[model samples]
Target chain A: MPAVAFTVVIALLANADIAFGQPPGGRPRPNLPPIPPKGDTTHTLTRDFVPASNTKSETAPHDNGFIQRWLALEPIRKEIQRNNILTETYIRTAFAENNFSTDFNVVPKNGRKVKVGDQRLQWHALDSKTFIFNLYNFTYAINKPPYGNIFWLVTVINCPEEIPNVRMAAGVNSGGMFWLNGEEALVLSGDRDMVVDNVVSQPLTLKKGKNIVRAAIINGPGMCTFAVRFLDENGSPVKNFTISYE
Target chain B: MKPTILTSLSILVMLATQTSAQIGQPFIHDPSTIVECDGKYYTFGTGGGGLISEDGWKWHGGAVRPGGGAAPDAMKIGDRYLVAYGATGGSSNHKGAIFTMWNKTLDPNSPDFKYSEPILVATSDGYEECDAIDPGLMLDPTTGKLWMSYGTYFGYSRMVELDPKTGGLAPGAEPVDVAIACEATAPAYHDGWYYLFATHGSCCDGPNSTYNIVVGRSKNVTGPFIDNVGRSMLEGGGKLVAATEGRLIGPGHFGRIIVEPGIEKMSLHYEADLDQGGRSVLAIRPLLWKNGWPVAGENIKAGTYVIQSERRGYALELAVDMVRMPVARWFNRSTDEPIKPVDTQKLEDVIGDWPSGNIDARIGDYMSRPHQKWNITPAPDSSGYLGAPYYKIVIEGTNRALAATADGKVITVPEFTGAPEQLWMIDQLTDGTYRIMPKQVPNSNEKLALISFGDSTPALGKFDVNSDNSKWSFRAP
Candidate 1:
């Protein structure tokens, strides 16, 4: 009877580990370098973002053309210089050499685990209720240090019809790179605050089908955030499309 | 009209000017035009935070504005709200930047509530002639173009165009000098004329502030705005719109709110409400347009008045059998005898004659009868609309209350139950006449005003500003 009770307890513990996407023994910790202490802790993490109320796990762009839904992978520790030495050359070279994923076009499933460098990170589906995504809050929410890390976000936009002459408008803090359908579309490399439509890509066409948008945001110190949207030739928001974490 | 009754109404008006202000914590400076969102009203002031009201009358502070700036203006465009404010400027330094942002919802608790990062639209260096503060936003109803007027007493007031879609500066749009010697400038359009409303004189001086609202009109949004007498606003010519009234001194920052077609209200702040400890407080008054120019209208005060229909020179009265007065046999009496004043018809003399049920109302000759005398008093415990409280129109000395029936008719009920149908909104129209509307019509959301359907008939109907049938005047009996 004591042996049977011990077996039952073992089964329950195994089920709990499986529920958290961990192996039976335990999840492996990321074998990454130690993270330095955060420089600033005075930032009032305003609970501005809320979970999207989409029942079908899909969302839409904001009325002002801001994309608010994304599937984010857990941050991977990275060495970054202070004083915003993050320039165009530094960011492009960093993103080019690091193979974060096997295929950029593939939209990772939420709760799925991925191995980047020596770190094993899980993917999460998040809906930013605000125009700008607060990366500090996002990292803190996932129990990870917000600074000195790289965050990878992916979203699938389903267009109703083929759209022409639409430009990708984006703003990001620190530095970031954007990809559309596995092709580099825009790169924002600077230490700056997020301003709406701060950098707009040249006019591009959106095919009448699912389009994958992926981004990698790198922050060395201070706050990190990003917002992206599509504007038509007339500069109005392209809101006819739907967003989902597929 | 009796001289004594006129004197009473005059006193009431004087008292209202000194006492009637927005209730609750309505303290604000340079309040923007009040905007309604999801049935709630919000108005942002000069500082950062603003006031929100479930009902327009009672205001308290819970509104949120991200950028702490001076003179913010808010407007709703499509499904989004655009907010523009000046970032910096004061008596010492005039260097400032005006920014615009978009928000999904003004209520902070809303799931979609978030403001787009503010984009700088206009700026001014201290060395420049103009200060880029005091941003007043106006969307041209005709062209769908958003325009902003900004500046201060430090330099020229200027107008610029903004992208209505992005809340950014319009492509290559330059600021055009519109007016000088004024700040807190706002633009309004009426009857094909674009009017530039601005605050003139000193501000932030409490009771001693010389601030007054003045305006000039032009045919174009990019205007050489001209006053009524053909003086250009660029030359500092502005027709006076509002000035110091009673204890509320320094009326500045004019914001116009159209309650309905014929009813409008102007929102401003009294630099010092002596009654409110000389603190700047929000005040809303009826906006009356006279001779193609806008002027501040008085809020109707609580008093006994004879409601006369403008359609016909007849009075609103209960449709009851006329009671006979005591016969003095004056035909045989001589003029030489000492005369005693004839007391007015008392409510007791005729209320017993009226049916205990609802009495239909009509327009008839007013003989100062008790039924024709309406005692309009602010209904207690009622959250009022916009600028004034909902009033209870009752017989002078009884509970017979004026109410709107489910059917499109006006009647006097036996008692004032404080029901929505019994509450009345008496708005002073632009023509100085009044349109009496119920707080709500029974079984319908349609807003109907008391109209003289015929010379002898009174009914609830659509308010037509051009027709005298929709107008009623409150006269002293």
Candidate 2:
């Protein structure tokens, strides 16, 4: 009976590895361009992001209603058009074909690997100290050019009770698309600069338990950053919820 | 004998160290005129940064300016902010260039924050008569034209016309020499006169800097500014506008802030603040007008005073029953009788008849009564307004505080609770009289000042500067 139980556990572990599209023992190296040297002292990068550790508890949104925690994937190289030509139709057509798996229901764990075309990318859980997450500094820290890249981010919000008439308010540099609970919530597509409350989603409900939020941001040839939070029906910040990476 | 001398010396030193400058980290040199933006106040300084204040009282440094320069001035033109600065000469060399730029917002965190490229408005060669620095901007309210005044002590202060739309030198404009022997010059418009306020004497000497602000006025925008004594500023003559006061010394770089119709304030930097380790610090004082000329007013010192209403020459007092003194029969009082001093009405004598609860306030004839004397002191743990700290006005030797009610009535609560309604903002108006306003009225946000409704009635109402009802005076009891 013990031998049978051990076999069942091994089978479950192997199934999980296969589901994440990762090898059992090690991650595969993808063919990519060479990284540039680090920036000079004039480009002082803010130390706002830190690796999400298990010992830390859940985080709360900022007083001004800004979310600052997410599980972000490394940049994926994409040959996108210039900012002026990036219209809603063009972005929708470019994003119609899936670059990776669309099964966002499963929360990606930290250090978990996934395959996008021939490239192997890993998820990084980070807690941002600032309201606006600086994607330029994040890419530059890893010796990669911060322009003309795409990034995916996800977060879990736990509500005490069912909340209705809540909207997602976001500001993004370049363009972005957001999804809540596996449903399309907001799409901000333009060659636009970051402005507070630039785009707000339609009113939606948050279930009593956990709700997942996923987003994809595309940038081209400029400083890349984004900020997001939830607002109530009366346009006030909805801060009575905890955020975590599930 | 030695101990007494030491004690006297310590008290003198302590008195010399007491200052009434703007609170918080208000350290800045050559500050521009304060401008209000998006519910906050900003003032840029000489270097490449400035200060921001949420309440106009406690200031800290967070303001952002791009170009590295000396003596920058900021103004809000329409929906955009225009900043002018001198890029080079503040030292031995006289060659410098003055540039101007525009920004949608002063807040660095805003997405609309981006400064337009600097436009060179004016310049000076090394041998020119004027060193192009310390630029001050004024958008003419009469003709709708923009003008800039820039120069230094190297030669003559000059004025030039600028295209308000582009923030550049106006077409076919030339520099016109306005004044001599003055730097950090700014232009102001009040009534029908155009005033040229400038700084004179030596600066940067800290404790020994002889810097003082002087002014001259003219009917036109350019040339022939005259002082009060019929002396032209071109001949090195200027009427003294502001000088050293209390622990603050060497006032320079005059800037004006019109808070309302009658309340005005002047902003400048003291070359040395003895209480602040001789650092250059920003100072804001009440701007009073005497005989149609600008003069710096005094900040009220904490003391006991008889609150007199300018409307009817009556004093603000508790509405309790009047207590009389012992009467002396006057039938036989005559001729060669030795004079004896009759004591004034004391608080102890009146306490027995007064009620120990909330009492209404009234304006009555002044007789130096105990209830008419108010002990005005700075409220502890209270944030201030623009110029000075909020004060708590209580009856002398009692905790009965002067407060405002929800129904626009003035009253005195038995004990001072340090509530918002109990704090008062006593501002010395431009006419040398004062306007007493409560920090907040109960159940309302409308700022109401203490007014003389009638001869014997004290109420809170909208302050009208022209009416005598809104004016008050404080006299030593």
Candidate 3:
């Protein structure tokens, strides 16, 4: 472990983009007035990656629910799963060409296969930095590509018994589609953040026993994350049920 | 003396020294300080969830940290525990805010465990060059004032003063920029220096993640912090503290606990562990000082041990000369005497020969008697210094405790009193032997450290870390 830690320190010292010991001697921002420790303008090291500040699978309570326990899979490109079918084509596009889409009806069938019991799915459990299943860094485990794309995240909600009017609120990165039991419950296609249940405006009704939630997340070139929760009519989190991947 | 509070260092070491670290369960991100409440250990993580351990060695998910956003930190102010966390401050949710609440206990089931309403301490408008996330809390030992450091790489890391009593911002307090080029800012104080430890580099990349810990020190809680090179932290000056462990990447979120005068431990989370399916887990490492700068020391390996007093090389024994009754042997079958359960040595059996108040703690031959045999276990639950946990020394096969009396004498108490006299901070010296000190010595500021008297008698004396009189080795009996 000491050897590994030392190697990282040395490699960081060797990287010019991330000059560790350099003094703050550079240009200033045009719009934002210079802040403290002036003379510093640009720092790519600070912009390297967005710390997944809220890495919780289940965020705090709100007027309604909580988003927790998600079993995410590695990131998969959007080309093949457009319009609910595998449409493979020659493409060298990156985040600048953020034109990507995923249809719940379409099954990409090919990516990193995850073993869920005896069944194998196109996506596998994303190695999350926290138990919350952070998707932004979750994708780095698969590949380094344009941040904006599509991901097929799968999670199983174990409802002890049948319930009526259990409102489902969700937060998705950028935007895309949401499915409950293979049925399209909501369609969000745009740029956005995973705001602990950002989709409360469009509430969802869930069935009891095993409820399958599949998120077709689309990002333009930034973080890819999502959260969902169940709530009662009063907007308090309905936590009697368990959130599981199995 | 009133029982001293259990510091974070001692509690973490209780399990760290004896067991292989179990960072896998509950699989939390950014775990909070390991705390001992109600004789058990508990810690909160991101996602409004946390973990608990009956023994420091095995942790499972069950703790509840209400209102969890990201990278939360916790500290006890008085009888209550105050937890602070970032509500939102990310690429998507840029308008970040730090929230805090206090609960008497980490357990939601406890009757005294009601959490106060969340209080807003600070906030950051995404465009303000500071994103208020990953808040780490510190209660200034010098002034008793509360301070919190919150921010991410999106902008500058800043420290905000908080009301120690209310878990809110102190009057007229404002966020002050302390560091940048990192996130999860933790403020730790040693001697006269307040060390600002933070995370640098890209995190959350599984095995590919390059997250490492860096540190800077300042004289005041708020500062113009500088690194070992004398470069300012405000200008990205930080000395490297720790980084990756081969396939393990991203060691972020710094938590410091002092076990003794010279021993400290740093706690953090590994962004990803290749050995654990790239899953994230909590990690604790010994914090060592070199030339006044703090660095991580080597990991500890567990071994069976016989704890002996350093003074005269005598093993810690029970107050009872008390006898170890012989079990029935084939040759001396007790069938003629009617078989019955045998009793361990009792205080009454040896009380007549010893002093009236404090039993004489003397050195006897290494006979490996049940009373002579001793097992040294980590008791993070016990009070200690630096980041190491104090040890619970019990007579093997019995509960009689070895305690240091107010008169600076070592004796065996009848039972485990859980008092300052019984709680001992055992420090391993340079030569591998140890100096055991009581957490408190009645009302005195001086620590009652175990020493070898001229006659090989066990007693307490003033401590000098380098003295051989206070050092004892742990041997395998």
Candidate 4:
């Protein structure tokens, strides 16, 4: 039995799964180890929204337990495909009359907020989870003509993942530009007549997760209207995504 | 033909001291007149007033005409001369005429200036905001017929016909619809095509002026003209010619045609700011024909015009001048369709019958002179009873087509199709008189022929075809 066990151990080591201890399930499985932490901070939490310092030890600002929970949602944001379709969301808070600035600090999931200054942030999922935060836009208005004649405003939105092997078109009059992730996507410009159709743009990359997108548009001479739609690998619209401008 | 220097100077004095002297008159843009008899050239343009030169070059400014029709565009038909002007009749209260003046000779030195009579061609039909003016004349070389294209009120171009001998409207022919312009002017012809060159967009809008010249061409003298890019002028379509280039301002009211050179070359005269760039001055340059169309001179020889001129013959600048008679008012049908003369009134019966009643045995044999190829021949007897004056012409170096006209005077045929109306039949009277008649003209037995001043061949006495005792080589308009 000792010889047989030694041979099994040797085989297991060679296969890169050999371990001496049993897993938490108490089954004789391969070595079970903890996933490396992505972010720096870690913390322990109980029920409710109480600060961690009020209940647990505040000895170190970094808590390994909090890091694991925060990183649990991080892998969900990874895209399956390469750089085809890109998706992103921008959140801007409304300003008061005097106009003040806003700052942001990273907050891990299930971790207590550390009050460093005037900034207020809470840990939440950034992807398809219910814990994701929403974005809003502020300070938008129209400008009159002569000086404002032939004006342009461009916007680009990113996708959660990359899409592939697809042709895309965007039509606008006034004009608009699109960008995917950090690379250039497409530019649609000029005086659009009654028959405005078939504007060619870059193909989209659709991954399993989040992608970055942006657009810029301009109004000229007369009224300005701009809208963009994407096509998939088979030149079909991707479903189940909502566009929110706040 | 003595050089009366004193009379010439007096005419100059009369020109300089004319009414409004130089102010508030309708500004004539590009004044150019072509008269055959006296071989003289006259110009009346903006600020330049009226000028005449025995030769085309050395010019002396003449007086501004009374009531003001600025730039004088003139053409001569037979013994009669006519001038068309703009700014002369563009007013709401003014039912002003086209400011037409007829002269017997183009000679500035001739004392027979009594033939210079001023008459309005026709007032606008009370339809538009502009009047009938800025006339361009083209004579169908093949048929000695006159055509006059002009501009009118309501932001459109208009046209009318004049009798070559009487200086009146042709019988049954009235003012017809041409093209339009935003702020249009200037109409000219080149090759066998009548080029309607006009200005589009805003003209006097200062630095923001959108003034530019656009052009269209048609095979018909009265056009369903198409531009270089295949847009019809009658459809308010044109391709840009001389637009506002760098430092050029208010470039409008242009005159363009192939210049008189030993070699084939085109030239355009336009008004624009010179280097001083104030007001405007007349400027000209050679134009190039590309892809079977014309582009400005600047575009060619600057590595453009991969194509070259392939047409022969000094494409003469001639206008057919038909004498306007009271009978011509009802000639043209209002529709765009070509109005055919009565079929029973074929060219043979309408014109004087040939002695042998055979066109091939008489005119065809005589017209078969050197370099004068006939495009028409007699059909075989089996084809049907041969008509008296029906002859099928096959001109040398051209497409095979039959020529049919009433009296070799006026032939009204559908432009694309070679209908019976395309036939020509000249009637000869016993008294050495001839009347060129269309196939089916309504009532008139004698119609005048519009002739051009050019040499068809040295053997042919004169380029004018309508006159008796001549066998000039004539081409289709």
Q: What are the TM-scores, per candidate, against the unseen true structure?
A: 0.61, 0.62, 0.47, 0.37
Q: Per-residue alpha-carbon lDDT of model 3 for B1-477, expressed as tens digits?
A: 000112212222221222232432324456776666776776676534566666454566567665535567887778888988666424242456778898898776798878888887877654355666788888888999888988765447899899999999999998899975567788987779998988765454344445678889999899888988675676456888898877666787888765456445677878676676566667766776666677766432233356566556666554545444465564655556776665655445544554334445666556555556555555535333333455667655455667877787888775666787787776554334566788777767786688776635777887766666777767776
lDDT of 2 by residue, A45-152 (tens): 244477766436588777776888888887887765344345678666655553455776658988898877677887878877767766766775565665677888
Model 1 chain B weakest lDDT span, ten residues long = B1-10
Candidate scoring better on DockQ of 2 and 3 = 3
**Superposed model 2: Cα runs more than 4 Å off:** A1-246, B1-25, B328-337
Candidate 4: TM-score, chain B only = 0.50
Q: What DockQ does each listed candidate score?
A: 0.01, 0.00, 0.02, 0.01
Worst 10 residues of 3 chain B by lDDT: B1-10
Looking at chain B only, the TM-scores across the models are 0.89, 0.92, 0.64, 0.50
Which regions in candidate 1 have their CA more than 4 angstroms from the true location? A1-246, B1-25, B324-343
Candidate 1: residue pairs that collide:
none
True contacts kept of each: 0.00, 0.00, 0.00, 0.00
Best by TM-score: 2
Report interface Cα RMSD per prediction.
30.0, 32.7, 20.7, 47.0
Model 1, span B23-78: residue lDDT tens? 64377767888889999988886535577888888976667776655678898999
Please state the CAPRI-style docking class of candidate 1. Answer: incorrect
